[model samples]
Target: MEDGTPSLLDDKKRTSKIARLSLLSLFNRFGFALNSIALPLFALAIGQDEAFYGVMVAAAGYVQAIALFPAGTLSDRKGRGAAILFGGIVNGACLFYLPFVTDSLMIIIVYALTGVGSGFTRTSLDSLIADHTKKGNERTKSYGITIAVATLAASTGPFLAGFIIDPVAFPLAADPLFRYAILFYIMGSFRLAAGIFGFFTERWLHDNPDITPAIVEEAEEEPDDSQELNGNSRDDLITAILFGTSQAMMGISSGMVVPFLIPWIYAAFNPDPIILGSVPAVANLTLASGTLFVGLQSERVGKIKMIFLLYLLTPLLTIGMVYIPIFLVMVGFYVIRMAVANMARPASNSLFMGEISSERRARSLALTRVMWTFPRQTGTLLTSYLLSIGIMGGIVNFGRFFFPIAFMLYPVCVIPMYLAVRRNKRIVEQRRQQRELTDSVEVP
Candidate 1:
């Protein structure tokens, strides 16, 4: 494990590093989840229609996506710690101001600005993990731990927000609308904590002479064609783009479901906050569980195959959501959908990381994030606007129209996931053959 290659297994000291990284992952994800859960409700509080809210949220995605590649390049050059810290502070500061802004345009602007921060943090965070851990099982475990922590934070954030943001809880409160702002503030605080934590734990290339350009140049100059296919290829890039696009499209399709689900469920039966929280809670738990499972198996299953299986399951799980009527049944479907979606996360991440050179990992991941976020934001903007127009005033009817669209588009997303896996497999096989040939010649 000490030989040049990275190891996923952690010694006692490395375990500490994983812990710190996991904490950072948790805090960062907490900030993201806090906004994701509250943003729509915040817009609703301000009398903004669905479309307006969608546009606001989607704008963030577009900005984040657009900024990702640049942010990655910067991270690769400047160091992950500094990048994350800067983004965190900026993101936190923006969150603190979110409560004060009332105008829709101003809110959109703020969201977009936050996107820049998001791009900075998100692009570098995973790469930081990759840098710390040696490639193989250790890498997989580290990523899995990160995902589990993030999912745990994401699962908890919304449930907590649901209680905090409930208007009834704030009957005598100074400004009920400000409750969402408070949540944002908490999220910001978490981001700040993550930034500080990251500052201490991240290993900067500038500080480590071993990882300097001299090493990179040597690695690049080595005429090892066998390892050529080990990294990202043009085909892998295309597949990544395709997969990213599909994920974004799915985001658009699924965007309406969350906003409408509560209302629809309430209309079908009596409104129960417990049920609302429970449904999503179950889903998130499933996702977290699946992430944990995948993380553990990341090496054994291989990253590419795991992603392919996960993508294939998405349409089936999501379509199941449309048919389930009972709240519990709906929760069941949600669980399946979430687990399947999340199971692919580690694999997808590994594939992205595996495909690119270490220097470009941040950029590649950022690009993937951009693709996923942009489409979802576009969808959110479109759907929210339509909902504001009362296109389908009823929740059930809206689900009927939207869920199917999401289901149909899911297969398209799978195409990229499949292609990436297949391309990776081809590359791996090619490399194996070349290695055998070289071994034979050397033996002679």
Candidate 2:
């Protein structure tokens, strides 16, 4: 469009695009970090109790699960930019509405809307990145760096909310419900700002009409996406299903942790906003570090192998999560363990990317979410009820109830993942060796 042909960027547009995407992540995550502490406290304050908190969390996941695959498929057919832009708007509106919510039921509805927004937004971004890069090391590094930057930006969310909640800044800090509402207001404003970033980023992407976006100003024939008579398509499908199943196994444990961890910490330790914010700050910091490590190590270590090895650490961390006696130690354990378990996530995603064909990439990723949905949906509720009941003979909060049960359940998710990785790895190796042998024979 600038000179009668599609120029992906002309220095200025490139800078504009990068700046917007970076700021978009920073502001959006700042809002989410506020919710990390506020949502649970708000539920309890409204007299809904922990069980309702479970339902609130479940409601979001349910909506996300339902919306994910369809949204991905739609984006592939339509355009990734529209999906991302719409998602940011929906999330911003939902967060803005959070400040006004008083009734528990209304809160649950907002949570669901945000969940739908998350599904569309996440799928679009993942697909967008894949569209921009070919299947290889470039894709791996791009995914890793993107996640690392966002997580690092989000690390400040808890601290910002915590500082605002400090009695030094706000008078309502003493009243739990009012304080939570104020935090929601601040975070919502940031989310609204994030919507602006998404809008600009979407507009700029219109200039570069490649695999990343379905909206091309030029009229061209679309590639046939059919799988009939395509051998590689069948192989890719098999690998995709296998990879998705394994990722779901890993997701179940993490899903259970997010909704209830702060509440658990409050019940077991203290309710200070400083404590609530600080813990997540540490977790996000470590996640950023872990993602960076994967990006740096991708070429040195095989992505699939690194992913498998990193996941092997899950059971150990989850086990330690339940048995740790001191709150500080438990928090430290949570940070390290989470980092260890997720350090290779970018690599795992890259592995998935390498296996699937371009046409089905987004939906394939969504299918992975679907695989994890039921287990996580059930796990969150089950853990919440179990936590409510306490342990045998009235002893739950001590050390043997909420987390240990999840530790015991961790294997159920990862075992299938291990098998899937092993099978996929073997297949890949066989293909490589056969190709090398054929190449040698052809040369002679």
Q: Who wins the lDDT comparison? A: 1
Q: Residue 416 of model 1: what lDDT?
A: 63
**Which residue window of length 10 is worst by lDDT in model 2?**
222-231
Candidate 2 to native Cα RMSD, angstroms: 6.5
Report the C-alpha lDDT of model 1 over 1-444, residue by residue, as the tens digit.
Answer: 476345332233455555677888988888776554476567667886456666776777788887788888888888898888888887888888888888778988987788888888887888887766544555666688788877876787767676677666445446868777788889889887777777766753334423311111113332343232346546546656766775666666555454455444445554434345555556677787789888878677777667667756776766667677766776687678767866676766655565556756676677678777766777666666666667777545676667556655654565666666566667777877988999999995
Error of 1 at 198 (Å): 1.9
lDDT tens readout by residue for model 2, 285-379: 99998898896677568775676667666657756765776888888877886677666767777666656677778887788877776567766
Give, for candidate 1, the lowest lDDT window spanning 10 residues.
211-220
lDDT of 2: 0.67
CA RMSD, predictions in order: 5.8, 6.5
Candidate 1 lDDT (Cα, whole model)? Answer: 0.68
* Number of the predicted model whose TM-score against the real structure is largest: 1
Candidate 1 at residue 25, lDDT?
Answer: 93
Q: Provide the overall lDDT of each model, using Cα atoms, as 2-decimal numbers.
A: 0.68, 0.67
223 Cα displacement, candidate 2 (Å): 24
Per-candidate TM vs. native?
Answer: 0.82, 0.80
